[model samples]
Target: MTGMFPATSMPDRDWWEALWPDPSGLLLSLGVEPSMTALDLCCGDGYFTAPLAKIVSGRVYALDLDPEMIVAAKAEVKHLGVSVLKWIVADAGDVAELIPEKIDFALIANTFHGVPDQPALVKAVARTLKPRGLFALVNWHQLPREHTTVLGQPRGPRAEMRMSPEAVAAVVEAAGFRLLRVVDLPPYHYGAVFEHKG
Candidate 1:
């Protein structure tokens, strides 16, 4: 584990929603299917977790390093009256050991850039997923932070930390995954989907 992902990678909820008004729709566009078990890796406050649980018939595992974040995520899921398969508070690298079963899909949104050893984290995710499972990373396009504002405030990680789709694909592919496709997320982000080569 490269420790917790940098906090700057996460933004306030208001701007987060402003940037992604339809999280569930976004997830679907990223190829999340209702029948596949999913994992919300580095799940911040569960903004997407609640909707993810809704999509996968509550067969979603939400994990974050911060306990407070888990509490908030639990509240969010409760507010929606949906349940997650498990709400785990642990480092992202510990995902394989923490989840009871291999997942069919995994998502790490907005937090991939800050990972100190990106390839290591990608390998960890690969280990947690079932063979041929999909892993999707939603990352800020390599644009200046000031230009990617939301709710009238510049959001997301620093400009230098932002990654282009090709850069992300390189790292993930090196970790025993095949690049599937990159989906344009508009405005300031993109989703890169990879299939585990296991």
Candidate 2:
């Protein structure tokens, strides 16, 4: 098991822009439009959110808990001239409180399992989206062995912080989201698109 992952302070613009999920191609595959407002939950540095803002010329609420990470994400958006993304400080419990309305899309990318109360989050984010809103749930596929990043960086979370797809799916379905697609293409990590049921 790995130790507590530190919030690496990214002083440079590139590092902040690089801190999100890589399976963005999957996001593209989901048919994201250029005029729909979206919410990016646990949006670390909002990397994907940046690209997403470009696609949706609409607003993106980039929500996260880490203050420095939130700051870095906003900086990146400003640097990239992305006027559509808004940074909101939030954890699992405070998301609904921050944005108490519906959005066209909701993205929980790469950071769902880190949440302490998974069920609460499922319900909270579900309430925040419009009926039939598209929600992309993405996480690392359970790899067979520990892996290293290309930069020789070890990547693994503490055992208590990880969650499996089936386990997560149960919570999401219970919150009224119907699984629309299960993407298992390449490079390992998995994602499920849940269409919020009205």
Candidate 3:
């Protein structure tokens, strides 16, 4: 079964912007290069997908389980006048079969901790990546939910559901990926970049 991550539903756009501030810069910091064939896995509302498309000149594939989210993402990218190479509405667990070509980078943000079969998901991602391909995860810091706030209110997944960088590395590395580095995204998030060892 496809497991929905806790708090996977996006916050209001205002709060999301307030938290991320600059989605494009965040992607760049995660080692997304212009020439890379990228996938925005679980691309809720295309907040990062549009910017990623702009960065890579529309050579990006975006997928989310929610068709409504995909529609919103299509509209978001349309509003921005940039295009994604493909928009897929399917479970994230089926990504290897969904994407048509090997990807240089894949990003799943704010949802990794809730995946029911993270190792399986990582292995599926490993199958879709090119050798030495990058997989980036953006997750909430493993802090008490009450301690991490946006707009003066607690936000993100429950405290017990959060995963530390080391924990993430252990799971991902076991599935044929090497942890590259952990980037502090500040105010309650961190970005972990991994390289697929094919």
Candidate 4:
């Protein structure tokens, strides 16, 4: 948790969503289908969870480590008219225990770089997924601290906390996930999709 963003400091949900790529379209591009069960790991404010619920026919688990974030996400999605999501307040590293059922897809957005033990987190995620389940991650592209902090630049974790795409892929591979593909998400981020080998 050295470089992680504090839950208390999170921006308004609408404001946060406006700052990044659309989660629904992004998930669709990553091969997320309407019939899949997905996990929105480290989900913050239901920004991605709401859209995921709309797209996935099966259940979507929106889990965050902070209890306040879980409450906020639940309130945020109440008006979506969709009841496909289950909110869980737990650490990202405890997915295996927190999520009892197998999942078809697991999504981690903008939070992987700050994970204290990337390999352990990936392993836990892998364990929660069914065989061949997809694990998609969106992270800040490695850049200089000054570059990310400039006025009008997209808000993200510090540059030192960012990890290169290759580094993230390597961790996923070491955790028993086969590399699928990496896609550029926009002016400031990249998405990597992997498949659970187990």
Top candidate on lDDT is 3
Give the Å shift of residue 125 in candidate 1.
0.6
RMSD for each of the candidates: 1.3, 4.3, 1.0, 2.7
Which pairs clash inside model 2? none
Per-residue lDDT of 72-161 in model 2, one digit per residue for the tens? 667767776786546776564667778856788888766676655678778888888889888888766665325513223444344445
| Model 2 ranges with Cα > 4 A deviation | 1-24, 158-161
Measured by TM-score, the strongest candidate is 3
Residues 1-198, model 4: lDDT tens digits:
432333224555555555555777888988789889999898877777878888885389988877887777786667676654567877778788987699999999878876778888999998999999999998777877556532455467667678898899888999898988998877667889999999
Worst 10 residues of 3 by lDDT: 1-10
Local distance difference test values of all predictions, in order: 0.88, 0.67, 0.91, 0.79
- Between which residue pairs do clashes occur in model 1? none
Clashes of 4: 0
Per-residue lDDT over 1-198 for candidate 3, one digit per residue giving the tens place of the 0 to 100 score? 654565677777877888989999999999999999999999998999999999998999999988888999999999989998889988888999988899999999988887888988899899989999999999999899999988988999888999999999999999999999999997789999999989
Model 1 scores what on Cα lDDT?
0.88
Candidate 1: lDDT of 49?
97
Which portions of model 3 show Cα errors greater than 4 Å? Answer: none
Give candidate 4's whole-model lDDT: 0.79
